[model samples]
Target: MKLQLRLSEWQLTQLRQQEQNLQEEETYLVTALNERRLPMGSSSESIARRLTTTGAGVRAVQAQASRQLDQVRAENRRVKHLEQIARAAAAARLRDAEARALEEMTNLHAGRRDRTATTGWLDSKE
Candidate 1:
């Protein structure tokens, strides 16, 4: 039996989307910082502090997303490993069952009466 991994495709897609969103957010934050850094009359100290804080927030979120993605990937790998082990065990069980059936058939045929044995005994008696 083919076993599906525990991690669903939708879940993986969501994780990837979250990672992408985090990267986009980081890019937006950096772009905003760069635009503000230019002497466009908004390089005031308070604005600089606010942008720094926002940048820090973006970094934090990106780090969290990276961690989540790593965890999800690790869980997927673990589940895949377990599925492989289960499949191997199932195959081994099937092989064992087939071997047992073949052994039984061999034994059954060996126990059956042979026509040669019966005819030879009758011929000797005659």
Candidate 2:
């Protein structure tokens, strides 16, 4: 669980970093598209295409980030559930062990009582 949680967190961090980078790329592309002058050999059509492609890239990263976030939440919930199960199991085992110990103690004392009754301790033949 610890390893899974750490991996999920790492993936989320990576997705966030990707999103930030995509945002910067989209911003730069939008700025370029808004320019009036056509740079060197680049045409307006090419600039528009770049902006569209950047928008698509941004959307893809956002979707990926959303998926990663969901995975993280699931991993967290799963870990908590597993922990609860482990705790319950441990508590049950402890209860069983205690019950057994109590039973053994009762039997031991009962045997001593029987033995003492059969041969009186005051008679020194026990």
Candidate 3:
């Protein structure tokens, strides 16, 4: 019996999308971090206040993005591990099939040899 591990096309597509989303989130966080590091001293008080608000918002976004990236990485790892297991199972099945085939061939050859020997003995007595 073979164990099948199959992923649907839609499932694969969804996984690819999730990976893309993780990449986008990482890029967004990097850009936000750069913006946050920019100088705030040159701005007026009100502008500084706005910048502070924006900075806080960006920090929150960065935290969430980091968490999401971690989750995506974990999911990717799990999928890869599953794929490896499936491949190993498939290889084992192939090996088993080959071994069975070889054993059957050997048995067939032995049977043929026995028949030929019996025929030779009958001909000798005739």
lDDT of 2 by residue, 1-126 (tens): 879889989988988898788789777666766766556787778878877887888789889889988989999999999999999999999999999999999999999999987778657763
> Any runs in candidate 1 off by more than 4 Å, and if so which?
1-46, 114-126
Please report, in order, the local distance difference test score of every candidate based on alpha carbons: 0.67, 0.85, 0.63
Give the residue spans of candidate 3 off by over 4 A. Answer: 1-43
Q: Give a tens-digit lDDT track for model 1, residues 27-57.
A: 6656666666544565556555765665666
Clashes of each: 0, 0, 0
| Residue 64 Cα positional deviation in candidate 1, in Å, after optimal superposition | 1.5
lDDT of 1 at 23: 59
Q: Which 10 consecutive residues of model 1 have the lowest summed lDDT?
A: 1-10
Off by over 4 Å in 2: 32-45, 121-126
TM-score of each: 0.59, 0.77, 0.60
